[model samples]
Target: MRADIVVGLQWGDEGKGKVVDYLASLYNAVVRFNGGPNAGHTVIANNTSFTFHHIPSGALRGTKLFIAPGMLVNPEILNEEILSLKQLVSSFYLKIDSRTSLITPADVVLDKKIEELKGASSIGTTLRGIGPAYSSKALRISPRVVDVLNESFDFSIYKKLYNVEFESELWLKNAKKTLKDYASDVREELLEILSKQGNVLFESAQGTLLDPIYGTYPYVTSSNTTASYAFVSSGIPYKYSGKVIGVLKAYSTRVGKGPMPTEMSEDLAMVIREGGKEYGATTGRARRIGWLDIPALKYATEINGTDEIFITKLDVLSGIKELKVAVSYNIDGKEVENFSPLENIESAKAVYQNLDPIPKLYASDISYIIKNGWRAAPVQMRKYVSFIEESLRTKISYASLGAERGMTVKVE
Candidate 1:
């Protein structure tokens, strides 16, 4: 069977974890293609909330989970996550690629020191050693999962290269004990699964706008967050690649420092932030809120070849007096619609089109909409989705009303 991909269209924290969890039940395996500890995908299932950093959100659905080579594995975080899952899930399949890069304590220290040196120019990173780990991998000095399992692996290489001292012995011992069981030839396994006609879901961590190459450079995450990279990271041939499902929110939100042209007023932002619980799942920092950015959304969809869109957190906009969508960007007095704002992000100003307000929805209204379909939604809510669909020229397959898996409306 072909592999379908789920990716975030905006900046990080686009509620992709919940989307993956909701869709995982239909697939046999879920593969995480990129990012690492810095990614926080929160899923609310069985009335229990799970914040996943390294594991796929499909864990609760008992889907087979694969950590691909494109990821950086932090043993401590993965260990804690496994322990937590054990309490709730009886048994789940998990495998890590032997070629996956390892994140060591030395890398964490290097991350902090580099951030400190950046000072005013710091990228507001999670400081989870993601950048440093990727850097080491590129330099061919990073240890892979298989290296940790090897008896001849040396830990002093970090000290010799970075001039830092850590509890190398303890880290080594714990890493071996934590990862030895899960490490395997994930490429071969994925191939075998595809040969057997098993359906797979590729779950991407960060959003396309934060990709290291295509995103707002220097301010973007360390890994490639685009959907096309999913095949490369998962070691699955492009021939098996299937539909690309792009996930976004009713409005845009970003956690770290970057140019968000459609940012709203501080007072309005605080209202939406609190209503949406807009805080970074990994860093707990308050996210910068903005109106839906159509230009950026269009760019993301085009780059990812998104076949369908899944919108989340539409409930957060209820009760607001008015709603606005950024139809274009004004750069140096020129109104531009096609070019991405990131081309001149610092000077680009968002041009918004105001729409009617969605009346405050009660719990019963949300329940009805969830139980029925989009036709049961408020007229204003339906209009909002229509505007977005027309703007992106993509069909919206799903709309999430709340955090629960059941709080979703399947579009007819």
Candidate 2:
């Protein structure tokens, strides 16, 4: 009953991997509750950078990892990740829930075809067949991991997948071979750990703004990406959910297509993007950069019930002279306090308030700033952190100064 949750507060790629990896030593188990191979969590520890697509970030720490039933698992991607991680962490053992949806090769092809049909309106998915696989699950035509291992299971169910004409025999054979040893009824395992009062971490893939139910419409991931879904994802009771930590970037970045209110100018964006290494770990696509949007952050906090915030990539703002925070939106000449829906969001204009200049801070400088009040720190940096604390009413627990494990500074 000691489960904690870590969620991305901004768009996806809020550095949840580094946070989870850093915190893995405190937990006995780390479970990826949602999303699929499309989600990439890059962890840097012991001088090696490992990109995790289907495995939990805790895998490198020898923390027991579990892929929950809510995830759409690509057996091929999971197999590759398992093999790659084993090369680094020899004791890596990942459990897959028997009820996890199977993402077959046919699903990958169908995902591309659907995106192609969308043309200019594509949702900008990772094209890893996530949406299509979820769609198959909803239609009850998708096979689960248990079915994949069952000798008598019928493969014809998935033939009715979205009316697509395809053969899945080869895909099934590959999946069966790849995931033969990983499949298990992980619910019992998780329950056993919980019964032992084990500290468990539920790591969610995507951010609150990318959730299907709460995020911007038609531009979101196909599953619930909030902390509230942790129980449903892990088959645990809601009361066990303890800490809901929200990981946010100092600035904002989005991949693919979406209405971004605080997007910076292309020239300014490139400065931050390169500074922060803002590129998709999975697709290598450059993320769209923007100033921190307080309105969006406020909305995320409300939905996820964030207890504390972990700010990442603070070093990226080093060279920028003046920082901007999107306090509110001017939509159709009317100022709004809350985040708008996709229709209104498309036309929303960001209203920014400038702060003092934040100089290029050294690690020692940040450590100083975190311990002492921002009084002697850079004027703008002090105002920036203060604004976040006052606005969200949440403490900034950790600040990631750089990409490495030791680069994180704890706020006292």
Which candidate leads in TM-score?
Answer: 1
Model 2 segments more than 4 A misplaced: 160-167, 362-380
lDDT of 1 by residue, 235-335 (tens): 78999988999999999998778888889899999999999999888889999999999999999999999999999999999999989999998898999
Q: At residue 235, what lDDT does model 2 achieve?
A: 87
Lowest lDDT 10-residue stretch of candidate 2: 157-166
Tens digits of lDDT, candidate 2, 310-368: 88887789769778889999998999988956548988999998876678888777677
Candidate 1: residue 342 lDDT (0-100): 49
| Clashes within 3 Å, all models in order | 0, 0
TM-score for candidate 1, residues paired by index:
0.98
| Per-model TM values vs. the true structure | 0.98, 0.95
How displaced is residue 354 in candidate 2, in Å? 0.9
